[model samples]
Target: MRGELTAKGRATRQRIIEGAAAVLRERGAALATLDDIMARTGTSKGQLFHYFPAGKDELLVAVAQFEADQVLEDQQPYLGCLDSWEAWQQWRDVVIERYEAQGDECPLGSLFFQIGRSTPGTRAIVIELLRQWQESLAAGVRALQGAGLVPADVDADIRAAALLAAIQGGVSILLSTGRSTHLRAALDQGIADLRGTSHAAV
Candidate 1:
Protein backbone atom coordinates (compact mmCIF):
# COMPACT_ATOMS: atom_id res chain seq x y z
CA MET A 1 0.00 0.00 0.00
CA ARG A 2 2.78 2.38 0.95
CA GLY A 3 4.74 1.58 -2.17
CA GLU A 4 2.08 3.16 -4.33
CA LEU A 5 1.85 6.38 -2.38
CA THR A 6 2.91 9.79 -3.75
CA ALA A 7 5.12 12.09 -1.67
CA LYS A 8 2.24 13.75 0.18
CA GLY A 9 0.45 10.43 0.52
CA ARG A 10 3.57 8.84 1.94
CA ALA A 11 3.92 11.63 4.47
CA THR A 12 0.28 11.25 5.51
CA ARG A 13 0.65 7.51 5.88
CA GLN A 14 3.76 7.98 7.96
CA ARG A 15 1.96 10.49 10.15
CA ILE A 16 -0.82 7.99 10.70
CA ILE A 17 1.63 5.24 11.54
CA GLU A 18 3.57 7.40 13.96
CA GLY A 19 0.36 8.56 15.58
CA ALA A 20 -0.87 4.98 15.85
CA ALA A 21 2.45 3.99 17.38
CA ALA A 22 2.09 6.66 20.03
CA VAL A 23 -1.47 5.56 20.79
CA LEU A 24 -0.41 1.93 21.03
CA ARG A 25 2.45 2.78 23.35
CA GLU A 26 0.22 4.79 25.61
CA ARG A 27 -2.93 2.61 25.59
CA GLY A 28 -1.36 -0.71 24.58
CA ALA A 29 -2.21 -2.87 21.57
CA ALA A 30 -4.91 -4.89 23.29
CA LEU A 31 -6.94 -1.84 24.22
CA ALA A 32 -6.30 0.63 21.43
CA THR A 33 -8.98 1.04 18.77
CA LEU A 34 -9.25 2.49 15.30
CA ASP A 35 -11.23 5.37 16.70
CA ASP A 36 -8.41 6.09 19.11
CA ILE A 37 -5.91 6.07 16.27
CA MET A 38 -8.13 8.26 14.11
CA ALA A 39 -8.50 10.77 16.90
CA ARG A 40 -4.78 10.75 17.61
CA THR A 41 -3.79 11.03 14.00
CA GLY A 42 -6.70 13.29 13.03
CA THR A 43 -7.32 10.93 10.18
CA SER A 44 -10.69 9.96 8.82
CA LYS A 45 -11.84 6.34 8.73
CA GLY A 46 -11.81 6.42 4.95
CA GLN A 47 -8.29 7.76 4.88
CA LEU A 48 -7.17 5.13 7.36
CA PHE A 49 -8.71 2.35 5.33
CA HIS A 50 -7.24 3.76 2.14
CA TYR A 51 -3.78 3.61 3.72
CA PHE A 52 -4.30 0.33 5.56
CA PRO A 53 -6.77 -1.75 3.60
CA ALA A 54 -6.82 -4.60 6.10
CA GLY A 55 -7.88 -2.43 9.04
CA LYS A 56 -6.39 -2.60 12.55
CA ASP A 57 -4.26 -5.66 12.01
CA GLU A 58 -2.53 -4.05 9.05
CA LEU A 59 -2.10 -0.81 10.95
CA LEU A 60 -0.60 -2.66 13.87
CA VAL A 61 1.97 -4.22 11.59
CA ALA A 62 2.94 -0.80 10.30
CA VAL A 63 3.29 0.52 13.83
CA ALA A 64 5.37 -2.52 14.74
CA GLN A 65 7.73 -1.68 11.94
CA PHE A 66 7.98 1.85 13.22
CA GLU A 67 8.80 0.68 16.73
CA ALA A 68 11.34 -1.77 15.37
CA ASP A 69 13.10 0.99 13.47
CA GLN A 70 13.17 3.08 16.61
CA VAL A 71 14.98 0.28 18.46
CA LEU A 72 18.05 0.78 16.27
CA GLU A 73 17.60 4.52 15.82
CA ASP A 74 17.86 4.96 19.56
CA GLN A 75 21.43 3.58 19.39
CA GLN A 76 22.46 6.35 16.97
CA PRO A 77 25.99 7.77 16.25
CA TYR A 78 27.55 5.61 18.95
CA LEU A 79 26.34 2.42 17.32
CA GLY A 80 27.47 3.76 13.96
CA CYS A 81 31.02 4.30 15.22
CA LEU A 82 32.64 1.65 17.43
CA ASP A 83 36.21 2.29 16.36
CA SER A 84 37.37 2.95 19.90
CA TRP A 85 36.78 1.46 23.35
CA GLU A 86 35.23 4.75 24.49
CA ALA A 87 32.81 4.68 21.55
CA TRP A 88 31.79 1.13 22.45
CA GLN A 89 31.20 2.16 26.04
CA GLN A 90 29.15 5.14 24.92
CA TRP A 91 27.07 2.91 22.71
CA ARG A 92 26.59 0.56 25.62
CA ASP A 93 25.40 3.42 27.79
CA VAL A 94 22.95 4.53 25.11
CA VAL A 95 21.53 1.01 24.86
CA ILE A 96 21.10 0.78 28.61
CA GLU A 97 19.61 4.23 28.82
CA ARG A 98 17.17 3.63 26.01
CA TYR A 99 15.89 0.35 27.46
CA GLU A 100 15.88 1.60 31.00
CA ALA A 101 13.85 4.63 29.96
CA GLN A 102 11.45 2.29 28.18
CA GLY A 103 11.26 0.36 31.47
CA ASP A 104 9.53 -2.99 30.83
CA GLU A 105 6.90 -1.65 28.45
CA CYS A 106 7.85 -2.79 24.97
CA PRO A 107 5.67 -1.22 22.30
CA LEU A 108 7.05 -3.54 19.63
CA GLY A 109 6.44 -6.59 21.78
CA SER A 110 2.90 -5.49 22.46
CA LEU A 111 2.24 -4.96 18.75
CA PHE A 112 3.63 -8.41 17.95
CA PHE A 113 1.57 -9.94 20.75
CA GLN A 114 -1.57 -8.40 19.33
CA ILE A 115 -0.63 -9.15 15.73
CA GLY A 116 0.62 -12.66 16.50
CA ARG A 117 4.37 -13.08 16.29
CA SER A 118 4.10 -15.93 13.78
CA THR A 119 2.10 -13.88 11.30
CA PRO A 120 4.17 -13.38 8.16
CA GLY A 121 4.20 -9.59 8.35
CA THR A 122 5.12 -9.46 12.02
CA ARG A 123 7.74 -12.18 11.66
CA ALA A 124 9.37 -10.43 8.72
CA ILE A 125 9.54 -7.22 10.73
CA VAL A 126 11.22 -9.04 13.58
CA ILE A 127 13.64 -10.81 11.27
CA GLU A 128 14.58 -7.61 9.50
CA LEU A 129 15.06 -5.78 12.77
CA LEU A 130 17.35 -8.46 14.13
CA ARG A 131 19.26 -8.71 10.89
CA GLN A 132 19.92 -4.98 10.78
CA TRP A 133 20.87 -4.91 14.45
CA GLN A 134 23.31 -7.78 14.10
CA GLU A 135 24.80 -6.25 10.98
CA SER A 136 25.42 -2.99 12.84
CA LEU A 137 27.10 -4.85 15.65
CA ALA A 138 29.20 -6.77 13.20
CA ALA A 139 30.11 -3.53 11.47
CA GLY A 140 31.15 -2.13 14.81
CA VAL A 141 33.39 -5.12 15.35
CA ARG A 142 34.86 -4.61 11.91
CA ALA A 143 35.49 -0.97 12.75
CA LEU A 144 37.46 -2.10 15.79
CA GLN A 145 39.50 -4.36 13.57
CA GLY A 146 40.05 -1.51 11.11
CA ALA A 147 41.36 0.56 14.01
CA GLY A 148 43.70 -2.32 15.03
CA LEU A 149 41.76 -2.68 18.32
CA VAL A 150 40.83 -6.25 17.46
CA PRO A 151 42.99 -8.93 15.83
CA ALA A 152 42.68 -9.63 12.10
CA ASP A 153 41.82 -13.25 12.89
CA VAL A 154 38.85 -12.34 15.11
CA ASP A 155 35.45 -13.18 13.65
CA ALA A 156 33.29 -10.04 13.68
CA ASP A 157 30.05 -11.78 12.75
CA ILE A 158 30.36 -14.41 15.46
CA ARG A 159 31.14 -11.85 18.12
CA ALA A 160 28.26 -9.65 16.96
CA ALA A 161 25.84 -12.59 17.04
CA ALA A 162 26.91 -13.53 20.56
CA LEU A 163 26.68 -9.98 21.77
CA LEU A 164 23.28 -9.56 20.13
CA ALA A 165 22.09 -12.76 21.84
CA ALA A 166 23.35 -11.56 25.20
CA ILE A 167 21.58 -8.24 24.78
CA GLN A 168 18.32 -9.97 23.83
CA GLY A 169 18.55 -12.26 26.82
CA GLY A 170 19.16 -9.32 29.08
CA VAL A 171 16.22 -7.42 27.57
CA SER A 172 13.94 -10.43 28.09
CA ILE A 173 14.91 -10.46 31.74
CA LEU A 174 14.35 -6.72 31.97
CA LEU A 175 10.85 -7.07 30.51
CA SER A 176 10.04 -9.74 33.07
CA THR A 177 11.83 -8.36 36.12
CA GLY A 178 11.75 -4.58 35.57
CA ARG A 179 15.49 -4.31 36.23
CA SER A 180 18.39 -3.38 33.96
CA THR A 181 20.98 -5.29 35.96
CA HIS A 182 21.21 -8.17 33.52
CA LEU A 183 21.27 -5.80 30.54
CA ARG A 184 24.06 -3.74 32.05
CA ALA A 185 26.01 -6.86 32.88
CA ALA A 186 25.54 -8.27 29.40
CA LEU A 187 26.79 -5.07 27.77
CA ASP A 188 29.62 -4.49 30.22
CA GLN A 189 30.83 -8.06 29.89
CA GLY A 190 30.42 -8.07 26.13
CA ILE A 191 32.49 -4.90 25.66
CA ALA A 192 35.01 -6.09 28.24
CA ASP A 193 35.43 -9.30 26.27
CA LEU A 194 35.86 -7.33 23.06
CA ARG A 195 38.53 -5.28 24.77
CA GLY A 196 40.14 -8.50 25.91
CA THR A 197 40.59 -9.38 22.24
CA SER A 198 42.75 -6.28 21.87
CA HIS A 199 45.09 -7.46 24.66
CA ALA A 200 45.29 -10.96 23.20
CA ALA A 201 46.18 -9.46 19.81
CA VAL A 202 49.00 -7.48 21.43
Candidate 2:
Protein backbone atom coordinates (compact mmCIF):
# COMPACT_ATOMS: atom_id res chain seq x y z
CA MET A 1 0.00 0.00 0.00
CA ARG A 2 1.15 3.54 -0.83
CA GLY A 3 0.15 6.97 0.30
CA GLU A 4 -1.62 9.18 -2.21
CA LEU A 5 -0.05 12.57 -2.74
CA THR A 6 -1.29 15.68 -4.50
CA ALA A 7 0.26 16.84 -7.78
CA LYS A 8 2.31 19.45 -5.98
CA GLY A 9 3.25 16.95 -3.32
CA ARG A 10 4.43 14.50 -5.94
CA ALA A 11 6.54 17.18 -7.65
CA THR A 12 8.15 18.12 -4.34
CA ARG A 13 8.91 14.52 -3.54
CA GLN A 14 10.46 13.95 -6.97
CA ARG A 15 12.58 17.07 -6.53
CA ILE A 16 13.86 15.69 -3.26
CA ILE A 17 14.58 12.32 -4.81
CA GLU A 18 16.47 13.81 -7.74
CA GLY A 19 18.41 16.12 -5.49
CA ALA A 20 19.24 13.26 -3.18
CA ALA A 21 20.37 11.14 -6.12
CA ALA A 22 22.71 13.90 -7.30
CA VAL A 23 24.13 14.29 -3.83
CA LEU A 24 24.64 10.56 -3.49
CA ARG A 25 26.45 10.45 -6.82
CA GLU A 26 28.65 13.40 -5.91
CA ARG A 27 29.31 12.21 -2.37
CA GLY A 28 29.15 8.49 -1.90
CA ALA A 29 25.97 7.12 -0.31
CA ALA A 30 27.86 6.22 2.85
CA LEU A 31 28.80 9.87 3.39
CA ALA A 32 25.66 11.68 2.17
CA THR A 33 23.40 12.95 4.94
CA LEU A 34 19.81 14.07 5.28
CA ASP A 35 20.94 17.64 5.87
CA ASP A 36 22.81 17.55 2.56
CA ILE A 37 19.62 16.56 0.78
CA MET A 38 17.74 19.26 2.71
CA ALA A 39 20.05 21.96 1.44
CA ARG A 40 20.14 20.54 -2.09
CA THR A 41 16.36 20.32 -2.42
CA GLY A 42 15.58 23.44 -0.35
CA THR A 43 13.33 21.42 1.88
CA SER A 44 13.15 21.35 5.65
CA LYS A 45 13.14 18.27 7.86
CA GLY A 46 9.38 18.40 8.31
CA GLN A 47 8.69 18.60 4.60
CA LEU A 48 11.15 15.83 3.92
CA PHE A 49 9.43 13.58 6.40
CA HIS A 50 6.02 14.72 5.19
CA TYR A 51 6.97 13.29 1.81
CA PHE A 52 9.17 10.36 2.76
CA PRO A 53 7.54 9.51 6.10
CA ALA A 54 9.94 6.72 7.06
CA GLY A 55 13.13 8.77 7.40
CA LYS A 56 16.48 8.43 5.61
CA ASP A 57 16.26 4.70 4.97
CA GLU A 58 13.00 5.21 3.12
CA LEU A 59 14.38 8.19 1.24
CA LEU A 60 17.39 6.06 0.31
CA VAL A 61 15.16 3.48 -1.33
CA ALA A 62 13.46 6.18 -3.35
CA VAL A 63 16.80 7.53 -4.44
CA ALA A 64 17.90 4.03 -5.37
CA GLN A 65 14.91 3.71 -7.69
CA PHE A 66 15.74 7.07 -9.25
CA GLU A 67 19.30 5.98 -9.94
CA ALA A 68 18.15 2.67 -11.39
CA ASP A 69 15.82 4.50 -13.75
CA GLN A 70 18.74 6.66 -14.88
CA VAL A 71 20.86 3.64 -15.78
CA LEU A 72 18.42 2.85 -18.62
CA GLU A 73 17.43 6.42 -19.45
CA ASP A 74 21.06 7.37 -20.08
CA GLN A 75 21.20 4.89 -22.96
CA GLN A 76 18.30 6.68 -24.65
CA PRO A 77 17.06 6.08 -28.25
CA TYR A 78 20.16 3.99 -29.02
CA LEU A 79 19.19 1.29 -26.54
CA GLY A 80 15.56 1.52 -27.58
CA CYS A 81 16.20 0.79 -31.26
CA LEU A 82 18.99 -1.68 -32.05
CA ASP A 83 17.67 -3.17 -35.27
CA SER A 84 20.82 -2.73 -37.35
CA TRP A 85 24.51 -3.45 -36.81
CA GLU A 86 25.08 0.28 -37.07
CA ALA A 87 22.55 0.86 -34.33
CA TRP A 88 24.14 -1.83 -32.18
CA GLN A 89 27.56 -0.27 -32.68
CA GLN A 90 26.25 3.14 -31.73
CA TRP A 91 24.63 1.67 -28.61
CA ARG A 92 27.87 -0.07 -27.70
CA ASP A 93 29.83 3.16 -27.98
CA VAL A 94 27.27 4.96 -25.84
CA VAL A 95 27.54 2.28 -23.15
CA ILE A 96 31.33 2.49 -23.09
CA GLU A 97 31.40 6.28 -23.07
CA ARG A 98 28.76 6.46 -20.37
CA TYR A 99 30.59 4.11 -18.00
CA GLU A 100 33.96 5.70 -18.75
CA ALA A 101 32.63 9.14 -17.98
CA GLN A 102 30.88 7.84 -14.87
CA GLY A 103 34.16 6.21 -13.74
CA ASP A 104 33.92 4.24 -10.45
CA GLU A 105 30.81 6.00 -9.22
CA CYS A 106 27.66 3.96 -9.68
CA PRO A 107 24.95 5.48 -7.52
CA LEU A 108 22.64 2.50 -7.83
CA GLY A 109 25.40 -0.03 -7.25
CA SER A 110 26.74 1.90 -4.30
CA LEU A 111 23.32 2.14 -2.75
CA PHE A 112 22.76 -1.58 -3.15
CA PHE A 113 26.11 -2.44 -1.63
CA GLN A 114 25.68 -0.01 1.25
CA ILE A 115 22.12 -1.02 2.04
CA GLY A 116 22.37 -4.63 0.96
CA ARG A 117 20.35 -6.11 -1.92
CA SER A 118 18.60 -8.39 0.54
CA THR A 119 16.33 -5.44 1.16
CA PRO A 120 13.22 -6.33 -0.84
CA GLY A 121 12.75 -2.93 -2.43
CA THR A 122 16.39 -2.70 -3.51
CA ARG A 123 16.29 -6.22 -4.91
CA ALA A 124 13.14 -5.50 -6.91
CA ILE A 125 14.61 -2.31 -8.38
CA VAL A 126 17.73 -4.09 -9.62
CA ILE A 127 15.82 -7.14 -10.88
CA GLU A 128 13.44 -4.95 -12.84
CA LEU A 129 16.25 -2.89 -14.36
CA LEU A 130 18.02 -5.97 -15.66
CA ARG A 131 14.79 -7.51 -16.94
CA GLN A 132 13.87 -4.40 -18.89
CA TRP A 133 17.40 -4.02 -20.25
CA GLN A 134 17.57 -7.65 -21.33
CA GLU A 135 14.15 -7.43 -22.96
CA SER A 136 15.23 -4.41 -25.00
CA LEU A 137 18.26 -6.30 -26.23
CA ALA A 138 16.09 -9.29 -27.09
CA ALA A 139 13.80 -7.06 -29.07
CA GLY A 140 16.74 -5.72 -31.04
CA VAL A 141 17.91 -9.23 -31.88
CA ARG A 142 14.44 -10.17 -33.07
CA ALA A 143 14.38 -7.08 -35.25
CA LEU A 144 17.61 -8.19 -36.90
CA GLN A 145 16.15 -11.61 -37.50
CA GLY A 146 13.11 -10.05 -39.09
CA ALA A 147 15.33 -7.99 -41.38
CA GLY A 148 17.13 -11.17 -42.53
CA LEU A 149 20.35 -9.98 -40.91
CA VAL A 150 20.19 -12.88 -38.46
CA PRO A 151 19.08 -16.44 -39.03
CA ALA A 152 15.41 -17.00 -38.33
CA ASP A 153 16.16 -19.90 -36.01
CA VAL A 154 18.47 -17.91 -33.79
CA ASP A 155 17.36 -17.57 -30.14
CA ALA A 156 16.98 -13.90 -29.41
CA ASP A 157 16.51 -14.41 -25.67
CA ILE A 158 19.69 -16.44 -25.17
CA ARG A 159 21.80 -14.15 -27.32
CA ALA A 160 20.44 -11.09 -25.58
CA ALA A 161 21.03 -12.69 -22.17
CA ALA A 162 24.63 -13.56 -23.03
CA LEU A 163 25.33 -10.09 -24.40
CA LEU A 164 23.74 -8.47 -21.38
CA ALA A 165 25.82 -10.66 -19.04
CA ALA A 166 28.97 -9.72 -20.96
CA ILE A 167 28.11 -6.06 -20.55
CA GLN A 168 27.51 -6.44 -16.81
CA GLY A 169 30.79 -8.33 -16.43
CA GLY A 170 32.64 -5.65 -18.34
CA VAL A 171 30.98 -2.90 -16.33
CA SER A 172 31.86 -4.70 -13.07
CA ILE A 173 35.47 -4.91 -14.20
CA LEU A 174 35.49 -1.24 -15.17
CA LEU A 175 34.15 -0.30 -11.77
CA SER A 176 37.02 -2.15 -10.15
CA THR A 177 39.85 -1.30 -12.62
CA GLY A 178 38.71 2.13 -13.92
CA ARG A 179 39.43 1.17 -17.52
CA SER A 180 36.98 0.84 -20.42
CA THR A 181 39.05 -1.78 -22.24
CA HIS A 182 37.07 -4.73 -20.88
CA LEU A 183 33.78 -3.05 -21.73
CA ARG A 184 34.94 -2.31 -25.26
CA ALA A 185 36.26 -5.80 -25.81
CA ALA A 186 33.12 -7.46 -24.49
CA LEU A 187 30.89 -5.34 -26.72
CA ASP A 188 33.10 -5.87 -29.74
CA GLN A 189 33.19 -9.63 -29.24
CA GLY A 190 29.44 -9.83 -28.67
CA ILE A 191 28.62 -7.80 -31.78
CA ALA A 192 31.19 -9.69 -33.84
CA ASP A 193 29.68 -12.98 -32.80
CA LEU A 194 26.27 -11.79 -33.87
CA ARG A 195 27.73 -10.72 -37.20
CA GLY A 196 29.35 -14.11 -37.55
CA THR A 197 25.98 -15.76 -37.16
CA SER A 198 24.67 -13.72 -40.08
CA HIS A 199 27.51 -14.86 -42.30
CA ALA A 200 27.09 -18.44 -41.18
CA ALA A 201 23.44 -18.30 -42.18
CA VAL A 202 24.34 -16.87 -45.55
Model 2 residue-pair collision total: 0
Q: What are the lDDT figures for the candidates, one per model?
A: 0.92, 0.91
Q: Please provide, for model 2 over 55-145, each residue's C-alpha lDDT reduced to its tens digit, 9 standing for 90 to 100.
A: 9989999999888888899998999999999999999989998999988877888999878879998999989999999999999999999
Off by over 4 Å in 2: 1-3
Error of 1 at 181 (Å): 0.7
True lDDT of residue 79, candidate 2 = 93
Error of 1 at 158 (Å): 0.8
lDDT by residue for model 1 (101-195), tens: 99999999999999998999999999999999999999999998898888988999999999999999999899999999999999999998988
* TM-score for candidate 1: 0.97
Residue 105 lDDT in model 2? 72
lDDT score of model 2? 0.91
For model 1, state the Cα shift of residue 43 in Å: 1.2
